[model samples]
Target chain A: MSSFLPDILALFFLFSLIIRRLGVNLAFQPATYQLLTYVLLLTIGLKGGQALTSEFTFSLISNSLIVIALGVVLTLVAMLIIHTFSAMNQSDRVTLAAHYGSVSVGTFAVALSYLQLKGVSYEAALNLYVALLELPSILVGLWWLNRNQSSTSLKTIFGHQSLMLLLIGLVIGGLYGDIAEPMVKQLQPLFAVMLALYLIHMGAVAGSKFGEFGSNQLFLICFAIFMPLLAAAIGLGTALLLGLSIGGTTLLMTLAASASYIAVPAVFEQAQPNANVAQALVASLAVTFSFNVIWGIPLYHHIAGVVA
Target chain B: MTLVFSFLTLLMLLAVTLVAQSTGMVVTNYFMLIAALVVYVGWKSRKSVKVSLLKRGRSAA
Candidate 1:
């Protein structure tokens, strides 16, 4: 039971939610969340880059291309569903689909922690898959939303703070891996604690959305819940075709299952000013993120184990 | 109306299928717990739902 410490700490989000409901005004500043996000993402990038320094193969390139394709397909399908079923305008639909289609770092961290807790071994290069999977969805969504104008430039998209941080870490770690090893090792022990704090912050944010849910949003709610499951199936099939290990399959599934609450929201707001970002947040952070943290990770692991 | 119902039904079916396919007791239990949470949310959202239904029924009457 002691070994389950990290897994247990994952529920701090629920604790944060309960305390907020009781009128505990802990007014955490925005910078706190921002700093936490930056540290964790950079850590992941460094680790993946370090591994690639030694283990880099042509296969990494191929795997990344496939993952990018997955992100694009997921975004397109989500846009189609929203367009078909909902009354959201073009910008809102594109914004919402981009949120669903991109990957969630928080969810990825939880899944990675789960794999480690279970003593499962996965490819170290899989960390690169996180950054790799983040871009294509947002790019595709931007293009789809602004197909008329030439405003969707590579500069604006790649300039996103989160993406830049990850890429910078990847480059530094890949080029100077020997020098970065000491820093990575120092940061390793603090990972779980940082994640717990981050989840608590996330929980409070998600909790605030609970009261905002209305019956009119039922289709969106259903889509939020169902998208992860559907994407997990796709992730699983891809993992198997690539001959990934069980741990790798589970992480891949989590990547596909997650929706972007951190990176894409700000970018989407900037890219499509007319879109209602709050609506997307309610679905992604409130419904899908909660589902993934509590249930989706374990279910994906179970399915992967059964298949492998 | 039928479209929303169709989607809800499809979601239920998919959730059931995934849970049914799980071989672990713990995983199955998680599914059960999520189902209960879904029901609670549904109950909470019933006010608007009931109001909409009541309006429809009165118009028909």
Candidate 2:
């Protein structure tokens, strides 16, 4: 399993970029991208829910709350840094905060894939942490953005497509338990395949956006790379405090290091229409996502190994 | 309509996975199948890839 897959992933990404450079558009449909992402999200939810069948506990609740709080803290800190360094307006700064604060599912998937490849075992239901960590920063961002006015209803936020699909998959897997074992096992083997496809799309997209790198100011680009490193440090500290294993520590570091490309933009598009969503996407997707996939995941693992 | 299709697809995929499992297909086979599928796609897209390689080579020359 480990022999050729990782090498193929990196090769596919570089190949995508090379293909693009040759003026071959590779015109994959929009729906194909959506379907790929949805499959990945559902698979994560299903696996986490299946694990939760036996592992769910009160301690899980405590850990989830801590993780959620970590999201809030990360967002607020992002808001501070962007406020100080970025000359962008208030809404833009808040939007950047939301992006930085929320976790990236693509990054989380890669981290999981990395652990599996290395035969590292983590806490079984860490996907619960992923789902829990998605929301708080978004809510905080909205609240800060619209402090003077009424914010988007929680119903609207919860109804976002990615979160809903994840929650639905989690509920289904949790409810079915061992009855879903065959399906879960089936889905498990397909994860790396699904993720590789997702990353290829991500790489193609990022490759196309490489031109946009220079359009962003120096501070934004610096923030994009450095923020994840700093966030990983914070994540590592929290994981140690929680007495998590090396795998758990690494995953937490990744969740901290990743910035949202999916949920934040969708929500911000609806709520803060005037906000600079494009800037946030360029930073998160083009800069942070690539960094995490290529380098940050392994680095976080090494740091986690050393520290925790 | 999109949401409905997504849900249906999920269900269908789950059923297929179960059926595949019950048929005694092992996990490694599934992995190999996906690996091959990826390779097939790459093969299909080889024209663009070749063009890109030639462009790079010509530029270097």
Classify candidate 2 by CAPRI docking class. Answer: incorrect
A90-166 per-residue lDDT for model 2 (tens digits):
98889998999999988898899889888999996678888888899899999887788976887657778788888
lDDT by residue (A1-308, candidate 1, tens digit) is 54222246556876777677776644358998888888888888888788889888798888888888889988988888787777778888888899988999889988888888889988876788888888888898888877888776566677777778888888889999879999999888888888888888888888778777554367666778778888888899889877899999999999998999877888877778788777887889988988888767877887888886
Model 2: runs farther than 4 Å from truth?
A1-8, A213-215, B1-61
> After aligning candidate 2 to the native by TM-score, how far in Å is the CA of A135 from where it should be?
0.7
All candidates' lDDT scores?
0.79, 0.77
lDDT of 2: 0.77
Candidate 1 — which residues are off by over 4 angstroms? A1-6, A25-27, A214-216, B1-22, B37-61
Cα error, residue A198 of model 1, in Å, equals: 0.9
Deviation in Å, model 2, residue B45 alpha carbon: 40
